[model samples]
Target: DQQVKQNSPSLSVQEGRISILNCDYTNSMFDYFLWYKKYPAEGPTFLISISSIKDKNEDGRFTVFLNKSAKHLSLHIVPSQPGDSAVYFCAASGLGGGSEKLVFGKGTKLTVNP
Candidate 1:
């Protein structure tokens, strides 16, 4: 069973527009949620993150929203640019026993068309 799920495998958007990627989780123990962007032949880099204590976190053109009760989270990109096109991953982690590991979703490929 996947603890984190990204139902949409892909998304396409026009340049200078907005892109929204959704994610769901089955684990209630998840206290931290993060979004990572990966380009082909490269590692996923940290994008934005939100703690369970906060419902939203934003940085630059990226924003992350978390809904604890629904076990859901979403990432929003404003003014999407071609450079923003990449595989977006949703990850969750919880602190326990002085250790924590992240559980990530498969990923959603975003295409930004010029």
Candidate 2:
């Protein structure tokens, strides 16, 4: 079974509008969550992360929210710009028994239309 899932395959938003991406996971053992943005032919670059203890984390225009009880998470970009258009992936890792591995969602493609 897939532990991580991105329900939406794509999203389109107008420039200067808010862009929201959603993700869900089935693994309750996951303690750390991360969001990464990737461009074509390039590796994913880490964007934001949140520990299980924290409900939200923000940096500049990007924010990540975690709902541990629901096993869900979301990423929000306010006043999204053209450059923000890219494929975004949500990743989760658990620190159990001193072993940790990252499980990632397929990804959601965000399109910012000017």
Candidate 3:
């Protein structure tokens, strides 16, 4: 059905602490996984991504891990800051010649307390 699922609607963490978000997908054809962070009324910014061929990808404070066997993926933020409070969306797409639009989950709102 092309559905990516993020079970948690929200997460809260203290500043300088680790924040983790989880997501799941049912489609086996999906070959790319992406994470996007969004601020209020602003477009989502690309955070990190992993291809099905790889298990882990990291970018500074952000990290993404993919488990192809379980059709699951997760995003981790190290030393979360007050500015990190925003919505996180997990997305996936299949490899194809034509346009493969990304399918996003409901999104998780992360709050970082100072």
Error of 3 at 35 (Å): 0.3
lDDT for each of the candidates? 0.93, 0.93, 0.92
Residue-wise C-alpha lDDT for candidate 3, range 5-110, written one tens digit per residue: 9999999999999999999999999999899999989999989888888999999999899999999999999989999999999999888421488989999999
Q: List the candidates' TM-scores in order.
A: 0.95, 0.95, 0.94
Cα lDDT of model 1 by residue, 58-89, tens digit:
99999899999999999999989999999999
- Those runs of model 3 whose alpha carbons end farther than 4 Å from true positions after fitting are 96-99
lDDT of 2 by residue, 20-93 (tens): 99999999988898999999999999899888888999999999999988999999999899999999999899
User: Model 3: which residue pairs collide?
Assistant: none
lDDT value for model 1? 0.93
Q: Scored by Cα lDDT, where does model 2 land?
A: 0.93
- TM-score: model 3 vs. ground truth: 0.94
RMSD after CA superposition, every candidate: 1.8, 2.0, 1.8
User: Residue pairs in steric clash, candidate 1?
Assistant: none
lDDT of 3: 0.92
Q: Which stretches of candidate 2 lie over 4 Å from their true place?
A: 96-99
For residue 11, give model 2's deviation from the true position in Å: 0.2
